[model samples]
Target: MASFKKTATGWRADVFKKGIRRSKTFRAKREAVAWSNQIEYEIEQGHHDTGAAPPNATMYHILERYRDDVSPKKRGARWEVTRLNQMMRDPLLADVKLSDVGPRHFSAWRDKRLKEVSGSTVNREFNLLTHACKLAWREWQWLKEHPMAGVSRPPENKPRDRVITDAEIESYVETSGFSFKTPPATVLSRVGAMFLFASETAMRGGEICKMKKTDIDFNKRVVYIPETKTGVPRWVPLSTKAIKILNHVLDYTKGTPTVFCVTASQRDALSRKIMKKAGLEGINFHDTRRTALTRLSQKFGPMELAKISGHQDLKILQSVYYAPDPSDLVEKLE
Candidate 1:
C-alpha cells in the first residue's frame, strides 16, 4: 500500500508493502504521488534493493573496502592503493555518502584536480573512482547507479613519439661502455648489456631489468617473459647481438635468480648517467622499445610484430612503434 499526504514543509509519500517500508518527501503533491507510484511498482517487480547500502556509509567506507580487499590483488595494486589513499584524505569526497554522490560532485572534484595535475594524470585518478563505483553497483549492489555515468572525463594527453637514432645508439653504447665487454664484469657491463638487450630484443625496460636467467634459453635464442603489462606471458626472440649481450651478463647475474639484479631506481639512475655521457638530451630508455619495434616492423607483419612486442592491440603497435621514414615510402612508390 502507498500513501501521499500534505505536510507542513512538503508532500510526503509512504509505501508499506512486500516487507518494505520507505518514505520520501517532495515539494509538490504530484511529485509525492509519482514517487509513491514508483515505489509501489519497484516493490511489485522485486527489482528494488531495499537500500543495499546503509544510508550512513560514506565514500571512505567504500574506498577502504576497495583498497584493502580488491586493489591488493591487482597487478597495479600499489598504484591503486596509493590513489585510494589520496582520495581518503580529501575532505570533500571522503565523507560523502556512496549513494548520494552525483555527477556535480565529481565534476567539482575534477575541476579541483585539474588545477593540481595534468589532464591525463587526473583522468587516471578518475578511473579509480569509476571502477570503484562500478564494482559497488555490480558486486556489492551498494549503488543503484554508477556515480561516474554522467561525469565528463578529462582529455588524455598524446603519447610520446620520440625517435632514437642508430647513431645515437652507437654513441650511447660507446659512452656508457655498454657495447662490448669481457667477463669479470662491472656494473657498467651488466646495466650496459641491459640497454643493448632492450634495444635488440624490443623488451620494455622493466622486463629487461627484471629478467631471470631461468627464463632465457640461449640454445633456443628466446627470452620468456613470465609476466607483462597485458597480463599475457610471451616469448621474445633474441638477435645474435642480443644473445651476446645476455651471455656477457650471465656471470654477473649468476649468483642471483634475477638477470639484472638491479632496482628500478638503480636502472633509472644508470640510464640517466649513460644519457649524460652520450651527450643525448630528452631521450628515455623506453625509446629503445620503439626503436626495436620500428626495426622489426621492417621484417614482420602486424600480427607477427604484435606477438614479438607483446601488444594485444595492433593499433597501439602501429601508432606507437611504427615510425617509418617518409623518404622510404617515397622511394618505394618511385
Candidate 2:
C-alpha cells in the first residue's frame, strides 16, 4: 500500500509492502501523489527496482561534473571552481552517495560550516551545492529528491552603508603616504585618477582598469562596457570630472590603448598607501561605487539608474546601493 502526507517543508510519500518500506518528499503535492501511484503500480506488477543509485557514485563525482561542464559557462566560473575545491576537501561530504544523502546530512554540514566561516560565505557555498543537487535530480536522474530543499541556510549580513567623503578623497589623492618621503609622481597620479573615475562613473575598479580606447566614444561622452559582472553590455555616460581625468590620462600615456595602464596589484598597493595617509577607517574602492550610486539616485529615476549602473534588478540598487540621507527627511520636517 502507498500513502502521502504533508510535512512542514513539503509532501511526503511512503510505500510499504512485503516488509519493505520506501519514502521520499517532494515540494509539490501532485508530484508526491504521482510518485506514490507509480510506486504502488510497480510493486503490484512485480517490478520495482527500489530507485537505487550506483554505489560508487558520490557527491564528489557530481561536483566534478558540474565544475567541468557547467562552471565554465558562468561569469563567476572561478568562484564556482573555488567552492567545489573547498567542498572536495571535506571527507564526509565528498563520500556521501547520491541515494544516501538526505536533509539530515545537509543540516549537519550547515551547522559545522557556520562555526568556521562567515554566514554569507556558507550561504554562497550552500547555493552552489543546491544547484548541483538540482542538476543531478533533474538532468542526470541520479537522485529522487533534492536534500538541500529541506535544509536551513545561514543568515547573511546586510549591505554596507559606508560612503566616502570629498575631503577624504582629496586627502587620498594629495600627499597620500608621503609624509616621510615623496611618492612616485606618475603612480600617484594614476591612482588618484582611478579613484576619481570610479567615483564619477560608478564602474567597478576591474572594469575601469581594463578599459581601452576603443570602448569610449569621446564625441558622445560615453564609455561602452563590453563585459560586465552581470554579463551585460552597457554604455556609461561620462561626467565632466570623468572626462577631465581621461583627458589627463591621454596626455600622460600617449600611445597606450588602455585608459589605466596599471596592474591590479599596483592599484591595490596605491590604495593601501592612500588609506594609510588619509587615516581613513573602513573605506574601500567599492565604497566609491556606493557613494556614486547614492548621489546619482537623487537625480535619476530607477530605470535611468539601472541603465547607467548596468543593474539588471532595481531592487538590488534600491536596497544595497541607495543610501538615502536622513538629513533630507529632517529638513522636510523642519
User: Which candidate leads in lDDT?
Assistant: 1
lDDT tens per residue, model 1, 176-257: 6654545625566566667777888789988887788889888999999998999899999888888877776776568886
| Model 2: residues with Cα > 4 Å off, grouped in runs | 1-55, 174-192, 251-257, 262-278, 328-334
| TM-score per model over all chains | 0.74, 0.71
Query: In candidate 2, what are the lDDT values of residues 1-334, reduced to their tens digit?
Result: 8788886557767777755455655789899889778767766776644433323567776776677679999867867987886786587687788768888888888889988988998998888999999988987777888877868888996778888888877777664422213322376668777887888889988788789988889999999999898988999999888897787776666677677687666788888877877788899988889889877877788999989888898889888887868996577588
lDDT of each: 0.79, 0.78
Candidate 1, position 5, lDDT: 81
Error in Å for residue 22 of model 2:
32
User: In lDDT terms, how accurate is model 1?
Assistant: 0.79
How much is the lDDT of residue 184 in candidate 1?
25
